[model samples]
Target: MHLSDHDLRQFDDAYLQTLTSAQARALLGKALADLKAARERLGQNPSNSSRPPSTRLPWEGVGGQETPAGEPEVPAVSGDVAAVADTPGAAAEPEETADPRPRRQGSRRPLSGAPPGRRPGTPGHSRTQHLPVDAEQSHRPTCCAGCGQALTDAHASRAHNARYEIELIQPGVGATGLLLHQTKHTYYECACDCGHWTQAQPGRAQAEVEWTVALTEWHLAGPLLVAFICALSQRMRLSRARVREFLSDWLGLELSTATINQCLHEAGRAVAPVVEAELYAAVRNVELRYADETSWKEHGRLRWLWVFTCATATLFVVGKRSVEVVRQVLGETFNGWLMSDGFWAYRDLDQRLRCLAHLIRKAQALEDGLEPAAQRFGIEILTVIATVMAAVYDARGAPPPAGALRARHAPMLNALLNECLRQRDAPHEKTRALARELLNDWDTFWVVLDHPELPLTNNEAERALRHWVIARRIGMGTRTAQGTRAFAHLASVIETCRKRAVSPWPYLAEVVRQRRQGLQAPPLPSPAS
Candidate 1:
């Protein structure tokens, strides 16, 4: 029954008009009330006897059947309908409900069939067959035994069964022994010249070397010496005896502190080249470098372990704290910027970037509890310095526009320098005077602003060197200059790998393996070989 376009339009209009604003609104309100009642009932008795009212509209009356008017008639239900319906305060049923939890599936059923015997295509089944011998069948020979004639069944029943047993012992401090048993039976043939014998070897035994390689590799990797032993004895505040006891109980290996030290030294030597190569590559690539030196004891004498680092790498050099040592580590011809605090040794380095953060700390201490005059002066100068440094950082990776930067910051810079000079010449306290002397290097300090990428603080380098400081406190510093160098090399590589998100152990292992196999000399920078 396809309706004409005109008829379809008229039908839609009539249907829409039937649901007039007020009538439609009333229907909705009644639906909401019904939904609320249903929800209250469900809440009171979740396992209710009432068949839930259908959300679907009822079918229009067909033929002569009269249609129920206004609301749809609900069907009767059995059991606890009244219990569910008694709750009036329950909330309305939601138009849409989502299950809050996931449902679990039932366990799988077992496969059902006859227990299978060896069949042609079945797994672990073979077609080849062997027949078993029975004592009664074997005794049924019908000849005489002396002349190799068949013997009577009654004479063949005299053969006796044989059995053997052996004991296996596990040798250790707490030894245990296991008994192994074997049984065999042999039949004597009527003919004396021929008899069949069968014997089974002991169950397959494991080769002694099965675990040897893995154990050797584990020890060679220095897990005990480097990680457990050294970390416990040196870093964890454990006594030497306690450390030894832990090794014996946990690893079944006993060692003195001196032996642990020797293993560490050997491991460091084995991995030194890989570390050195990484440090050299990192230093060569970074454009800005931070360097600092801290006191270290070597062979009972005072020395220094100088650390240098950038975004990509960390390198350490051990020597006496002299300007010459710094100059040597950082080649004279090298032209990149070096960040450090106001150490006079670094003063001669043409491209030094003084740490303004250190100066700020000193100024902050001086202005504490002071009059506005000093405080104001200190604040203004620090603010100007910070602003200029920020501008430099903002312009990093590119040259700042000619007069656009310095011209904008010039007035603030002049004002701060003039105030600093005035404070320096004034009759002030000793601390303030010393601060003034430090600030007098404003020309060199503020030069950092001209280079956008160079940081105003040497914090990066100091942070890179922090681990050494902690290690020195823990282990009382390296014992010799060579030991110091080894520490620097290994630490440099390990930290560099960490920064690059590479695992150091695998890299070190490969490098050591290649060196040991004599497949390469100096495992550092071989591109092809």
Candidate 2:
């Protein structure tokens, strides 16, 4: 039935007029087939295929992405948008610097548009623990400034500055029955023999990129406390107010929501540099990576959260869902096999494995419809695919070489391709689309046959996003740029640890401690043997 270019050119009206009745019927059939194809192309819509909803016309009915086979179609759940911003209980909005001016209460307050962070100098909570200082340490200059001379404790003139740090007592430290301990650090100015006064100061660390919440050692909360807050908010998916309530009710710590919120941001900012530089570097070296994206909201506006995962590490990014994001993650020349659904962004990658489950779902939709031809096509394709998949499964530990597999499965594969070619202009729009999709990325569809080690679906990446998708539904989304960064970096660390069979809490606490001391946080802990 194949026609060459010259044969196709002979179908003009001038040549058709001279045909006899039998020839004329053959020509008429071809003309009707072309008309049907043109009409089917014009009928494309989002519900029937991978086309975006925006492409749907005004007359079309509303629908979302086609749900996969055997999985119930979960409608978008709407609820009150929980605020996870730097400002506790505030709605999602742009990050704003906290105003130092005093804000009045109740009726005197403005109706709307209060800037983010703590609202204009409202009184904040103070520490409830009044424990006595367990130890005190003094810092003083040991050398003269003007002259090269050694100094002793007698050279200390006076204690100029002092601060207290409340740290959690380690589990096996003492039998004092105290959960916390305090340390008083006193800084003194020592007078040298040359009459030069050198002052010792407490060390301070700041974020390389400024955020709404500042990262410094002056805060009342210790590194472990900050890490605990992150575990509650980021890992446990608790809102700011919920975290405050948990601490107050359970730990007898009367922490303001503002402080809890700041701790979350500070922890995120602390580990962000290490997460971005080291963790992402690890992701780039994996051989088989899976990726998926889901909707996210930033400041009440639409955004996307992308996840890239492998066996040992996972990375999450909150940004635009574009090809550039894929390139940014996998680099311009990624040689590893990618397992993903048929997103346009992933199409350009030379080595990819299309998720067969997605194709099977589309074929199932065709089978469930009223068209006889479509249903038959669907049943045939599904049987063909299932047989190949089962064969792959049976070969579990010992996969046949590509040549052997091709020899065994070539007849079935050829038959499926022939059917797809015949049904390319199917009367059912979905049938036509399914056929065309298979034909376009035919190699990706059968890549698993050639490389048995590659996955058959993108379930790993999708599973990684499942928990956060619920968080997105519960908390709406992050409110500011800092919140977005915190959510992504912290989630990456948490999931990566879970994948590697390690606990992230202790490592995260250590990261906060080192970063606050103006030192680089340590690399993410590796999986235990």
Candidate 3:
């Protein structure tokens, strides 16, 4: 769709609403042409569009049947094409039956799929059964729970079902002291017997300083240690002072803030290497890596809290928002698709999917503003992208959009970009600034479509950063350099455990347990391990 210079000039915010009747006709003509072109180009879908996955309609695939991948079950048609084909005089573009591909559908499921919900040979894995049982009581129903029928002897006279019952133990602090005796033997050099004596390995133990490490003193067992850490961080979101008060009041134990700080420091030290290794392993080989950064205050200095995440792990780093930090996290050569916003640090990276949500939000700002030209541009951009996304949803995981449809959409996209470039020097600051920004990072807007696995948005990384953002806003950011490092490590471990479906408390408690006993910290948990 082409706009004449006169038509384009009418896009000026002040000129549009006051246009004469003749100018109105010209503008309408241009808009109609653009809209007509837009109707032909359909490639957007929730998978490829700026529209989020959460916004997907539940009825998308209502009438559709599940077909095996790469083999869409198309209904065979038995009818006439020649009549309509011949009647269309222009180019004889064929008229055919509706696309036989199954329509996209959505559903509400607590879990994504309907699995057996238990493994083979698994015995009674319900929630009540999962926790340790303290007591069990059996009671025959004296009266029906619903109808109040008297049936104290119903089981004796009629069909009855036996049900197992489990009662949970009450919540109470259990403190246990552990005495771990470590013994090492050293052998002397070989003599006439001709057997050489090997030296014993050195003990990793050190004096149990008051603040040696979290759970490092062995004064607390695994359950208590895990409970304490969970109370301090995840469950209660409590400060050290609060944790002290909680233990003092409930558990009848006194813990100083300094002691609590030492515990966290020790926990951080024990878990740092293991967590870092797992983070790298988890994110390194993933199909898509989402990266994001936000403001972090470290020792009263403004810094960046960066998060790199994949499906199986999340790694956090707090430091300067610089290329060096990205390099440190991602290494020099990453071949996987990296999804991120259009940050200058991410520029020139290979295999990157720019966050469409960021661009769409910018367009939304324009859509809401008063400038007619800018508003129209923003609205059209949103429409075209949403249209393309709808088409993508219908693709049902088919290969990328074909050349013909891509070609049709190409001009429409070019027109928008051209319009942006044309208005780069517009008197309207918003229009000019947006145009300049789009022009500056133009390539990122469309590069990911070639790789179906690359995400269209960096929402994963953004969501990963959200928890810390809330915490930081509440003045929970680190106050010391060491504390900052510890926080990043702990956050990384917590997030990675969640991603891997392992309980952080159990794994962390084990790490601390090993550390306190002069043993090495355990590796990341797996079934085989």
Point to the candidate with the largest lDDT.
Answer: 2
Candidate 2 lDDT over residue span 170-235, tens digit each: 466455532666788888888997888887775567646457666677677888777778888877
Better of 1 and 2 by lDDT: 2
**Candidate 2: residue 145 lDDT (0-100):** 69
- Model 3, span 62-175: residue lDDT tens: 322234568655543323454554556746555856654543355223334445567778696322313233333333334433444444332333222222221112243684
Name the regions of candidate 1 deviating beyond 4 angstroms: 1-246, 274-278, 369-377, 389-400, 425-440, 513-529
Candidates in order, TM-scores: namely 0.51, 0.74, 0.59
Candidate 1 TM-score, true structure as reference: 0.51
Clashes of 1: 6
lDDT of 3: 0.63
Q: Give the TM-score comparing model 3 with the true structure, all chains together.
A: 0.59
**Candidate that scores best on TM-score:** 2
lDDT of 2: 0.79
Query: What is the lDDT for 305 in model 3?
Result: 94
